[model samples]
Every structure is written in structure tokens, then in C-alpha cells.
Target: MDSDSHPAAAPADDKTWEELVKNVLRAEMMRRGVSYAALAERLAAFGITDNELNLRNKVSRGRFTAVFLMQVLKALEVEWVHVPASIDDAARKGGAQALAASKRQP
Candidate 1:
């Protein structure tokens, strides 16, 4: 997807790295006007089945593997942001805070 077409980058908050990444994917989908079904169809071209694609899109921790993430990025036509390399110290701290918050949630 064209960088110009993407939504304005939001400031990273107290959200886990995974949550932040998932939010980015959701935001990109909205910006592209692509439905989950359409994304699944595109992933099918990469041999990712509907059920598997659906699970991946759900953003459950264990459900999202590295390969799955790569496929999702490819299907979404979004620039792949490498987590470890791209996340700054502030982002990492925010993610840690988010993780702590989730653990405290009842």
C-alpha cells in the first residue's frame, strides 16, 4: 500500500508490542477499505486457508506466528515493520507497561 494512503501514524501508548502491531494491521485494513473476507481471499493466493487466516486476524498471542505475520503483511500490502528493529526504547517501555496492565486486569 502506498505510504500516502496510510492513516497518520499514531503515537505509541501503553500497549503491548503485539497489540500495537495488531492495531496497525486493523488500521491499515480500514484505510484500504478492505474487509476481513477480502483479506482472507488474498491470503488464499499464498496458500493460507480461510480458517487459518481468520485465526491470524483475531490477533490472539499464540495464533500469530512469524510466518503468519509476514503473510498478513504481504496480503495487506502494508510495509512490514520489524518489531525488534523498529520499536524504540519508549515503545518497548510502553509495551512493558501494557503487559503489566493486562496482568493486573481481573
Candidate 2:
């Protein structure tokens, strides 16, 4: 039987993954003082257009493709750290809740 075909192991919350990746990318960019424009230019050299970068930046939740994450990591010149599945889940849930709260008007 196919592993994914089983009902017990559904997909992990994607919103969490997107949020976590976004946070990590943002933090790394900030730490290196790399502006979006600068990153855009660098990515452009690699044939990753500004529009694509913007879309990646806008992803709020979902499974982050390894290729996409690696591209960003390469642009940032950072090593990848493996995060536990539980941590990713928590981060995604927390990020989603925070985003929802921030969108609410007073």
C-alpha cells in the first residue's frame, strides 16, 4: 500500500511551513542587511525573476519545495539547518494565528 494513501498520516499543515520559511528568510535577510531590491537583483542574475520572488515571499502557508528553499538559501549565502517536524508545525500554527490576529481591525 502507498504510504500517502493511508488516512492516518495526512499532510502537515502547509500554512505553518510557509510562515516558518518566510520568517527564516526574513530574519536571515535582515541579519545580513540585505534589502529586497538587492536580493531581487541577485536572484535575477540566477534567472529567478522579481515576480517569482515576490510570490515566494507572499506564500503564507504550505509545503515549501526544497528547490525553492535552496534557491533562497543560495542567494542568502547561508547554510540550512534541519528543523524538527514538531517545531515546524508549532511555528506554522503560531504564525497563522498571529497573522489572523494582525488582520483584525480594532
Candidate 3:
């Protein structure tokens, strides 16, 4: 109810995007009753080789590449992901910030 509690002022940083992506993937997995081992097997059907432990680590870190995200979604047979516009905007901003930061790190 208070302005300080609003997410609009949240920092659009890597951590925000990481948490968002992690939550989305985990929620999807829960929705479909899919475990890490089961997900690994499903990915194998599509020629993606990943063990349950690796999958767990990746999802836990929430720092995987977009290609990996697509692979997992495809393996899950997910047609689409429904992200709120505000969240999507924030994630995009976060991505841009990350890219900019990487560019400056050299």
C-alpha cells in the first residue's frame, strides 16, 4: 500500500531477472509435475544431454543462456510463457544493464 513497497522502484539488475526466470521455470515444472530427472529425460528425447544434478544447478543459479531456456521450455512442451508487461519491461532493462556492465568490465 505504501510507495516504498512498490516494485516499480525495484532495481532492474541481473538479480531481479535471475529470480524472475527461476520462479517462472520452477513454477512451470511444478505445474506439469516434472522433476529434474524427468526433465533431463525429456530433454534427451530432443538430443539435449544434461544430468539431473546439472539441471538442478542451472535452475538453482538461474543464470542459464536463452538457448538453454528455450531448450528446457521446448522439452516441457510449453507453448508460451505469460509474463506481465511490467515484469517483462523490467527484465529487458535488466538484460540491457547486464550487457552494459559486461562491456564496461574490460
Candidate 4:
């Protein structure tokens, strides 16, 4: 049984999680038809002051902090987040790679 014969599954890296969160948040925003301007207003209601450009940059970069995520979710009135049964499925369906591919299209 050579170790090289069967490679083990690689752990989920930070980028994967970041992209997943980014996709989820953006999707939710899209679903609710909430623009960055609108979202900024909603967040302000929670005492989370952030401009539209900053929010867009933060979300597009997918590097926001957990506290920021909580604030956004709360502002969006998100009761629950849907999790895929497997991370692989999520990556395929709503991961950074998928997001990038979609952006490249016309």
C-alpha cells in the first residue's frame, strides 16, 4: 500500500471558505434585489457604518471579517444559511472558481 497510490483529500483552504462566503452573500443580496447602496443603508441601521464602495470592495475581495459577515447577514434579515451537503458540491456550484467563470462571460 504505497501512500502515493491513493492521495488523501486536501483540506479546505482559506480561499475556498472566502469564496464560498462571498458567493453566498452576493447570492442572497441578488435574491433580495439589494444593491450596495441599499445594503449600506441597512447596515447603517445596525450602527455599522460603511460606504457602498467599501462594501463592494470588501465583498468582491472576499476577505471580510466574521463580524462583518454577521452584520451583513443581520442587516439582510437572513434567518438561516443553506449549507451544501458536501464542500465539493459547494465549490462546484457556488465557489470562487464558479464565480470567476461567470464573470468572464458576456
Q: Rate the local accuracy (lDDT) of all candidates.
A: 0.57, 0.58, 0.73, 0.74
Off by over 4 Å in 1: 1-15, 60-63, 80-106
- Error (Å) of candidate 4 at residue 80 is 0.6
lDDT of 3 at 33: 81
Q: Write the per-residue lDDT of candidate 4 for residues 7-87, one digit (tens) a residue.
A: 445446987666667877886786577889999999999888999999999998789889999999899987877653344
lDDT of 4 at 18: 67
**Candidate that scores best on TM-score:** 4
**After superposition, which runs of candidate 3 have C-alpha atoms over 4 Å from their true positions?**
1-10, 85-106
User: Among all windows of ten consecutive residues in candidate 1, which has the lowest summed lDDT?
Assistant: 97-106
Tell me each candidate's RMSD, in Å, in order. Answer: 12.0, 9.6, 12.2, 8.0
Model 1, 5-24: lDDT tens digits are 86544556535555556654
Give the Å shift of residue 58 in candidate 3: 0.3
Model 1 has an lDDT value of 0.57
> What TM-score, to 2 decimals, does candidate 1 have?
0.52
TM per candidate comes to 0.52, 0.54, 0.70, 0.71
Which digits, one per residue and each the tens of the lDDT, describe model 2 over residues 2-83? 8656433334765555666666665556556777778777777789876645744554343557887777668878774434
* Colliding pairs, model 1: none
Which clashing pairs does model 4 show?
none
